[model samples]
Target chain A: MLDDVVFWVLAVVAVAAGVAVFRVDSMARATYALAVSFVAVGLVLLLFDLQFLGVITVLMMVMEMAIMAIYMIMFMGMNPALMPMSMVHAKRPSLAVAVVTFVVLASGAVLIPWPSRRGAPASDLTVSLGQALMGSKMLVMMTVSAVLFATIIGALVLAVPRGRYDRLGDDLRGRVDADQPDGAGQ
Target chain B: MTLQTVLLVAAALFSVGLYGAISQQVVVMVMMGLELMLNAVVLAAGGFWWFLSPAPDGQVLLLVVITAMTVEMAMGFAVATLLHRTRNEDMTDMATDLAQ
Candidate 1:
């Protein structure tokens, strides 16, 4: 009973905050609203005994939002100007799409014949998850690690303008190379 | 608690995200919509694992999805910044040059 109540409450918050994302004028608020929505979803996951996944979701989203905020500030990248800007476009058709999707998915959820439950879950779900990752799913772990490394390098290449030559000397080698605001040697 | 209830919430979140992604002009807002959609998938997956199968496969799938979401969001923001730098604007409308 309590589980149902908590789930519904979190569900409402997630949906409301999601709606707020597009309704808000500023980019910062929209980002934060999305973070809140994800955090609520993460909490909901905890109810299912997915402790690692749930906690990681909250932590990951918090870090992602913070990075987004910093990028917005540093690059003057987002719609942070004093002049307000409308965030939404194409209203009517979008509403129709949303309503249609909800109807379709809700009906499918209700009407579909689900398969019978399988074997019981282990007493320690987190242990099972960990073993699966480091065990048979080692390939996925390795692939994800590669992807994350690529993401870091790719993001830096695209987002950062400076290079060794730019920050360092023309020779591409300076011990105390000077680049204001954001230089190396940190 | 029940699979049906969790699935309902997930579907609702997905639709809301669909609306936001379609209606929003700003690139960041669009990305937020996409994230919400992904979040809905995470919830539904968790619900499935809890009530239906309770298997390792579902848990692994969720982890992969979460990783994908993180990578996608970071790349999206980076691309948005690059686009904004090029034209001093981030609205989807400004991207019409390619079509023309």
Candidate 2:
């Protein structure tokens, strides 16, 4: 009974914070609201016995929100994100669509005849998960690693305003570029 | 703790995200909407694994989802930076020229 209560409370917090993301005026508030929503969902995952995912979710989301706040402040020209501004557009149609989607999904959740569990859970979930990653799912893990590396490189390439060529000169042997900002270079 | 209740919560979260994604004018706000939607997916997947499958594969799937969310958000920030630098615009409506 206590578990159910906790789950419901987290669920409410998650959904309410999600709603607040758009309702809030400032971009920082919206970003932190989404972070709160993710943290609540992470707690719900913990309730479901997904320890690694729950903890990772909390950590990753908090970090992501912090980075997002930095980007919002940095990228938003004229300090618009810092000022109070309307965050939404075409609100009526969006509301209608969201309402319809929720109704359909909720009805399906209540009406569908779900399958029963066929077997019990593993005694040591983390051990089994590690074994699976090192065993049958090794290929998937490798691919994901590659993808993550590529994402890091790709995002950096896109985000950096000046390339190495510009910083290092044609021969790539410049000690420090004149245009380089302080504390930005090694 | 029942599947129905968990799913209902997911549905609510997803719908709110949908609203934000569709209605938000700012690029980062839209990304936040997308993240919220993925957050709902994570919750629903955890519920499914706990109540139905109870396997390592489900956990792996959640991990992949989280990784994808991270990758997508990173790329989104990069793209937003590029757009702002090149066009000096952040609103979706201002980028309509890209559709041409």
Please tell me which predicted candidate would have the highest TM-score against the true structure: 2
**Candidate 1 clashing pairs?**
none
lDDT by residue (tens digit), candidate 2, A79-183: 645688795788999999999999999999999998987577788787887888999999879999999999999999898888876677788787775555731
Worst 10 residues of 2 chain B by lDDT: B88-97
Worst-scoring 10-residue span by lDDT in model 2 chain A: A177-186
lDDT of 1 by residue, B10-71 (tens): 99999999998888776766777888899999999999998898888789999999999999
Candidate 2 runs further than 4 Å off:
A77-82, A165-186
Model 1, runs deviating above 4 Å: A71-84, A164-186, B98-100
Best by DockQ: 2
User: Could you give the CAPRI-style class of model 1?
Assistant: medium
- Candidate 1 per-residue C-alpha lDDT over A3-39 given as tens digits, one digit per residue, 9 for 90 to 100: 8899888989988988887777666777788889999
DockQ, all candidates in order: 0.72, 0.84
Top lDDT prediction, candidate number: 2
Name the lDDT value of residue A45 in candidate 2: 90
